[model samples]
Target: MTLFWAGAYALTRVAVDKGNPDMGLPVAWVLPGRLTIGAAVLWVLMLARGQKLPPLRDRKRWVAIIGMGLAGSVFPFFLITTAQETVNSSLAA
Candidate 1:
């Protein structure tokens, strides 16, 4: 998780450096795209390694997953990238 967050921060800083003031990427790729790709890669790795994923069958687990996705996934995805748009990665850290 730490590594993932660090990579997200790095990606956001780099993407921001290449994007516009509006945080728009006129090109084919963007920060969110990169983050999605990273997630996909990690998911694939976990699957290949036969790692057990979160059980979303339970109501409580579902809620936890939703909360985690919103808090740990989506929130950081936007915040880190947007922050990187204006601040240096080291300073943001």
Candidate 2:
């Protein structure tokens, strides 16, 4: 997890740096693509391990899951991506 987290910042920096007038790749596109790919990979791994999806009918569970996703995943990614626009990736990390 630590290594993956570090690598994410480094790779995000690379992506941002590579963006220019010609390429015009925004952080908006990059961040969601990264998240989607990560989620897909995790879903595949869970399936490979024979993991079952939890019941979505449970409202409280859904709330907690959403909260965690926003707090743990989405928020941090947005913050980092926004910061990386000005801050050095190494410093951001």
Candidate with maximal lDDT: 2
Candidate 1 residue-wise lDDT, 1-93, digit = tens = 798767656756666663456554522346458757868998999999999777666788879877987797677656656666667777776
Q: How close is candidate 1 to the true structure, as a TM-score?
A: 0.62
Question: Tens-digit lDDT track for model 2 on 1-93?
Answer: 899988887888777764342453578888899989999998999999999777988889889988999999899888898777667778889
Assess every candidate by TM-score.
0.62, 0.83
lDDT of each: 0.68, 0.81
TM-score, candidate number 2:
0.83
